[model samples]
Target: MTDLNQAIETLSHHEEGVFPRKALETLLDNQEAVNPQLLDYLESVAIDPTGTIESWQTDFLVVALFLLAQFRDVRAYQPLIKLLNKLDSETDWILGEEGLSRILASVCDGDVTPLQALAENPEIAEYIRSEAFYALLTLVCRGQWDKSALHDYCRRMLEGGLNYEGGYLRISLTHICEMMMFSDLLETIRNCYQKWPEMSEFIRFDEVEESLQSGEADEFGLSFHRDYITDAIADLEKHACFVAGDGAEGDDLDGFDLSELFGSPDDVASEVEGFFANAETQETFVRDLPKVGRNDPCPCGSGKKFKKCCGK
Candidate 1:
């Protein structure tokens, strides 16, 4: 067996030397038999600063935790909450946002008390603060908190300057708008947006009207429009750049156009329409979109598949 396989075998009791996918399937099938093992594995990894654990091991742990939550195993709450808090402190050491998000999705349904506690902590890290904001918005969207409470909480947090970092603050503000929209707290949302014009890109009136007409506000409510607007604004900002001028370092080139390189606007529109017109094309487009794959080269450009490189 390979050395990694041997290592997995030494750590786990399964016959195979590899972290078995069947283990996860089995755990999901029978929560009682696998929860203890899953909990032990999660605790070990939570304290593992060196990150010697394999990617499959982490994946299995996360899956098992999610299953635990799905099964309504209240015992999983404390450990999951503790991990969320520590993940903020050790963002670099952990498996990054994907792992954190998976954990959040698992435990978010049980009890939001942990999130509230984290928000109230004086030593909250920037990562934790951002996550708490996200969690609160999620709770609001899920109808766990009433509209008035959610609005007041978001307002208090923002006014308190808990999310003072530029990027974190911007994201928090965007999420606040999302929560307000979900709860139909439009007056409050508009107040906050008016107070911060920089947040205009994060809110969209057209999509809100569309959602209202379609009666599709049941899930994310009108906030889906705000997210779309923010995404479009972000895309525009990403492509905005200044090119070098004659002798000077550079000149601000606002309203620069690159339609020639991309053909006509009609051509661009057709390509986009074609992408959405066929299932195969849509699937291909989605697959090509930036994503992390276990078999693809590590994003760090380590020249190795994620499972065998940094993710290892």
Candidate 2:
């Protein structure tokens, strides 16, 4: 327990016990020393995630990411982005939706360009890319970025054109508009629906219109703003991801049954995992995003080639 590697090992190698709070405490006390090691560990994992996936029984990676983010360590940003870029869906099974949100939001390094890339890159997984959209909100909420700039950026992204394959990105942007209360973007959002009619699976035009009609953003809090160690510890204190010494696993679904967090492996276009605050509203976002084949007639039925119509 004298070093971070040992602490990481302790957290990683445990079997049938409570979360190893002691090891985490040791690393937190030695944050300055552990940060270098933490960055290395993150970079190594980001470079080659095989080790993490192969030895996936423990909560160690969770500990590593939470620790790095707790300190807002800029060194970890690129590695974290790389990890997500190179990440397979199996790895996301471990991070879960909320976990992904926390990590992406804090690791932005005050420059959202990387996050913008992640959000815009259709090659990356949808859930991962979608989280980046919300991470912008987190930055704005924390007062680190200008909401107006974000609004303009989002408008440009909207104007850039959204194809069928990346329809979910438009929906994610729609969610952002609601959060920021961008009434001016209402027409832009409507245009998105016009282009990608399938967006109704997650949100209806009237719903967005009604939400905007209220003219207020809902209270939102996704990232921690208090003491890092205390909040990070609080996050896992009764969590079910790890087996603690006391053997008190919390009531939430265990990590083993986490397929719902991403989607059924058989389905490529995954369903939604709730990251929203209201239960009813969260349900509105949950659906297995339907895919539109390239050659098939466009759903919008503009009487043109599918590609010429609402194309990806």
Candidate 3:
């Protein structure tokens, strides 16, 4: 058995990928039963840190939570739930909410009250709420809930439709319709054109009918178009909200095309080092690398096509 003491000690450097995956895999592979020590370690990592210094710990924690689920033990559920409670659309923890949804999809088992609570909470960020909304939708669509109850749930989802910032909600709605198939909600979505008459200019059904007549129609094509209309209705304006600006040194190369100088990343790094060591060689360092055709034999002489070998 792998030493549990060493595994727990290595988590202080959880920002590195190898330790978490190895530690969790060891815990999962060895014991037939759930270990309280392992569970405690998962809980500590899963908790969102208040300081930015350990911000990347959230990513490590998410990986741990997912590894916990592979064992199918219910003990992992509560720690995963606590991660869901920390979802913030504005936060840098990209996987915290998304990872929770993925883990819950398999383990919730008809108990989606926690998901519903997060979805209904107005205080949560809109993006996180939309994620929770889709997670609940996924459960309802897959679970063996009563037909009437399912219908009610779908109605509530459409009625409480999301505002289309970042276009995430529309994407979620499209997925829900495609997965759930034809239902009462399809009719409800069709009637949305009448209720929001202004959106009619943005959405049209003529092409959908034409495609159906021409045998070119796709499943849920109408739902896909409706999602587009939802985005159009929002009259999206460019916002710097999610746009990541380049670093200070990179900002000076605004109109420059940097792709002309190319080589393998390692070769480029070596050239950069050489240039730093002797500034006079800068001009000669940038040169084109010989290109290899995809179908040609690999230069490595392993007797395989380049595309099928290292080119991949």
Per-residue lDDT tens digits for candidate 2, residues 120-172, read 76666666776676777677877777989889978988887433264666777
Kindly give the number of clashing pairs for every candidate.
0, 6, 0
Model 1 residue 257 lDDT score: 70
Cα RMSD (angstroms) for every candidate in the order listed: 15.9, 13.7, 15.9
Where does candidate 3 clash, by residue pair? none
Candidate 3 lDDT over 1-312, as tens digits, reads 346655544543543213344655455565454356547756664474344324644333443445455544567666656655665545524443223443554456556677667666655555455555555544554552443554565566556543332223333443344344524455555554345443323223342223324543234422212221111101111111112333423557778877777888999999898978887655665554334556433333222234545575
lDDT of 1 by residue, 1-312 (tens): 644334334434433223344434444455565567667766666666236244444433434444554554556667666655665443432333322322443456636677767665545455554445555655554565565776666666555444352323443444454435444444444554456554433234333334334533334322321221112112212211111223443365578775657977899899998876875654443442334455433334222234544555
Off by over 4 Å in 1: 1-23, 48-59, 88-96, 99-110, 120-128, 141-143, 161-163, 182-312
TM per model? Answer: 0.48, 0.68, 0.51
Q: Evaluate residue 94 in candidate 2 and report its C-alpha lDDT on the 0 to 100 scale.
A: 54
Superposed on all Cα atoms, model 3 deviates from the true structure by an RMSD in Å of: 15.9
Please report, as a residue range, the 10-residue window in candidate 3 with the lowest summed lDDT.
228-237
Pairs of residues clashing in candidate 1: none
Off by over 4 Å in 2: 1-6, 14-17, 55-58, 161-167, 220-230, 238-240, 243-312
